[model samples]
Target: MNTDTIVAVATPAGKGGVAVVRLSGSEALAVAMGHLTASRLQPRKATFCRFTDTAGQLVDEVLATWFPAPHSYTGEEMVEISCHGSPYVQQEVVAELIASGARLAEPGEFTLRAFANGKLDLSQAEAVADLIDSATPAQHRLAVSQLRGGYANELKRLRQQLLDLTSLLELELDFSQEDVEFADRCTMLDTVAQLQSRVQSLLGSFSTGNALKQGVPVAILGRANAGKSTLLNALLGDDRAIVSPIAGTTRDTIEETMTIDGITFRFIDTAGLSQSDDELEALGFARSIKAAQQATILLFVRSVTIPFNAYATDDIAYFTDQCDMSSKHLFIVHNKCDLPHESNPPGHIVSAKEGLGIDSLKASMVAAMRKDASANDGVLLTNLRHRSALQRVQEALLHVAEGLGQQMPTDLVAVDLRDAIYHLGTITGDVTNDELLGNIFSRFCVGK
Candidate 1:
């Protein structure tokens, strides 16, 4: 436990209506009181007071609130000073507190203390950072869910089951000399199978969770002069991409992001796919193919003004051969609907220049994502560290299942079981180390 008091400016640096400087630790109150006009403070009450330096000169008039130990954010005695938002006022007040014996806080020290004091688990502590950094509603909801213990509760249940099985297996090992079995091998195998299934399900959610956390990648692909860049500008409600009549105007990918119905989509407008004699144009085509391969969704744009038989329909054949579409959501979009066409294909028809049918296209994209999200359970695994730990748990469970199936010695099976438990424990901080904690908390902003 940290005994020395730590202080920091909690609010973002700049002028606002007010600024908050936070202090936490055993000596927080004493350090704060030393620089205030009031001799004592009422716990949890905001008292207007005059802040002064050690030389007894007034620095600022402030509203100070005190939170007693074990009930505050860090479960330690805490003091919050609400001062004028002037940069000089904020800096002077902090300097006064430091002169009175409070040290400057490191990044994430406040939340670190909260975790150290048992106010939050390891996963929830990470969620605090996520919630702070979330830009979209989907990301915010995922972070809030994890912070509320919805995800942690699920892991606790799994860890409890593993503990129960491990205890039984260890007991059986102890009774081996007597040639007696305490745990039925068949029952143990069944439990291990169930655990593996749950672990695998969590692992499966990582892709969707990560996509939601980081915007989903959507690649807009088509032949040259197909209005792919025009469609990109229309979807973004801005002229983000260059609109040119010349073919191959976009020699590389132009990326932009937009939030539709709370989900963020990263739209990549790639160079039009075509066999170009120019080396630069060919390099752009290569990048386009790479973008298509990585995209979760692909929009194949076609110009209605262009004849279907033009280029002998070789571009479509080339795209089909170059990209794997089996796992991706494919949308055929016919651009330039305002122009005359011989036939209307069976797909979305739109005029990118006039912003026609853009809303419908956005709706379709959202619908596809909703369908994908509906396939998973409510719990999502967004953190890469959690995903890695769960993956190890799955691997260990697999080994346990294999050993049990092969009728391996009880001691060997128990070893695998322990490995799975240890990995699972790492997620919720049932097992943790100094290095892991440092890596996690250091990412947080100071005074959080």
Candidate 2:
């Protein structure tokens, strides 16, 4: 446990109903009580008192709550002072606490202390930051599930299973001269295969999990004068992109974000895909192709004025070939539906200029996002770091299974099993380093 006390204003830096200054560590209570006029401070009870400086000048009429060691946020004595939301009052209270021997906390240092004191594991600690930053209902659900030991609990169970098997293999090594097998070869292979299957399942969820955690990328693709920019503006409900009847008016891609049914969709309106001799337009056209390739969802916008056969245009065909269209969720959208054209177009019809069919298009996008979403009742692996570690675990498990099949030495098999266990432990902080902790916690807000 840390010996020195730390203090910081735990609320946002602005005027509000109230602001909180928190203190933790051995001297937290002492520093907090030094400024309070009340003679008795009860644990877990909020005491209303007047806060004052060392010179007996009143600062604010605040409520202070005390928490004794081992039952508080940082597993140490803690105090929280709630005062009127004034920046001056907050600063003065902090200054008074510092004068009484509390130092300001560093970014994420409070949560780091909590982790160090065994209040939370590494995964749960990361979840603390996620819960704070969650912008939507889905994100909040995921963070809460993780904080409740979602993937961390599952990984712990898996690691324990591997550890048990490895111990059996180790025992066989000790009695190698007798040629006795402590672990059944068939049973060990079966266990490894099961572990591998679970790891792969989690690895597959990375795509959906990451997209939900961050924002989904949707790329708008079509030729010039296809109302691509108009469609973008309509989807955003604002004049985000310039619309012009002139061909190739959009020389570059315009990116904007909008929330659809609690999911953030980043829409990128790219330049039209046509053979252009102009240098900058050519560069933008190349960028458009790149965006189409990278987008999670592709909106192949087309105008009704353009014949339905335009779907087979050389540029469209080239783009389809360049991007493995099968990998991404592709949606064909016919814009300018109000105008006269062919009897049938190969997609959802919409008039971006008239705001028709926009709601249906949004619904389709949300459906695409939820197509593979199973009941997400437990923790999903949203962090790339967690996915990478699970991938390594999967590889190590595969090695163990293969070694067991080939009747490799028990000690060699044990090495692979241990490697798999170590990788699993990394997710739950059973095996971690200072650098990884620093990188994870640095993204947190200063007061957290």
Candidate 3:
């Protein structure tokens, strides 16, 4: 939006088949024309030319593409030079671009300008990052839907609906003394109910989406020789954790990440939970307790051989006492499925050594991951900030429902509805602060 020329290397920094150096602004064509050693060129057309340095020395032979103003990205003239993959060529081309007229762009500066020029909205701009960082098929689908305007469409419709309800409430406030009705009570109730349901549904996707982006953290916890570490290595299909007949062989927590059915899981293998007189073992017990508190799911492991914790009352007292029932999901895993199934955990039975029943364990993990959000939906809320803001909006809408059902003053109901609408708008940056805007835009790499 500043109208000054911007330049950046659009391609990755390292060696590639070819590298792209990009420029955007009113002077973009002029800068490109001079560097490409051409007198003139057509817009949106690719031109083969020689790129030169300021001293008029030939740097590289490359292809340049120009896109003219108002119809291009950033709503301005844009040009890109495809040069040799050599780092020297890329650097020289970018240097000449800055020397000729363009300024080096900040991280995400190109996309920020495009947003300012109305080339893309806030949500669409955000999708650019999501698309870049996407690792799985589901993540790609969400980003593409958002980039294609699916989320923006839904949010816009919800905002307009809130506006209509508020307009009626305002009208009723104006006619308060005469006892004339502008907003029908029944109609308002139906609208509020419908909106509350939609917002809450959308809110549901955050937990699943975020967990998909960051591997779901599950902790394996149990007392000595309960086969917790053995289960971990078997689940990961590797000897990631040490196994032995000796009790307390694992003195520290070990972690490994893997993707199952496109969902990443971080398995934290904890030390044997035992009241040991050994100083090091005692320290390990402390670390396991810390991890247990932070874990998303607690795998209370037991062996078919041991069948139960030997020191359960003394060693596994944390689960029985300060366990967060709601925050942490619990999964009881019975290890040593290689032998005849024995009486053990009430939930799941598996052998980490043979990978027996591991598929069921993964299924159970994914089901627990979906507890807060449905991954089957088309649109999802992945950002935590948006979730928190939307939660506030949801609470305000509840207040609105309370006010309307109690036959409260029209002005009071209008205020609550307006507050809810404002919070919802904040999620999409329709109502946002400069600091938050800075944080959001700062994540982008230049030349988007």
Give candidate 2 misplaced runs (Cα > 4 Å): 313-317, 324-327, 375-379
Instruction: Kindly give the number of clashing pairs for every candidate.
Output: 0, 0, 2
Per-model TM values vs. the true structure? 0.92, 0.92, 0.86
Q: Which 10-residue span in candidate 3 carries the lowest summed lDDT?
A: 307-316
**Quick one: ranking by lDDT, best first?**
1, 2, 3
Predict model 2's lDDT versus the native: 0.86
Worst 10-residue lDDT window for candidate 1 reads: 311-320
Model 1 score (lDDT): 0.89
Winner on lDDT between 2 and 3 is 2
Q: Give the per-residue lDDT digits (tens) of candidate 1, residues 24-115.
A: 98999999988899878999999999999999899899999999999999999999999999999999999889988999999999999999
User: In the order shown, what is each candidate's alpha-carbon RMSD?
Assistant: 2.5, 2.3, 3.4
Question: Please, what is the whole-model Cα lDDT of each candidate in the order they appear?
Answer: 0.89, 0.86, 0.80
lDDT score for residue 398 of model 2: 87
Worst 10 residues of 2 by lDDT: 370-379
Candidate 3 per-residue lDDT over residues 63-168, each given as its tens digit: 9888887778778888989999998888889988898889998878778777777787777888888899888765676677778855678878888999999989
TM-score, predicted candidate 2 vs. hidden true structure: 0.92
Off by over 4 Å in 1: 305-327, 342-346
lDDT tens digits, residue span 1-448, model 2: 3569999999999898899999998999989888999997899999999999999999999999999988988788999999999999999999999999999888888888888888998888999999999998767767877788557777777878888898889888889999998778998888888888788777877766777778778899988889999999999999999998898989888999888898888899999966668888899999999988878788988888877775535656767778876547878888898999787645789999999999999999988877634533344788878888899999898889999999998888888889998888788888888898889889887778
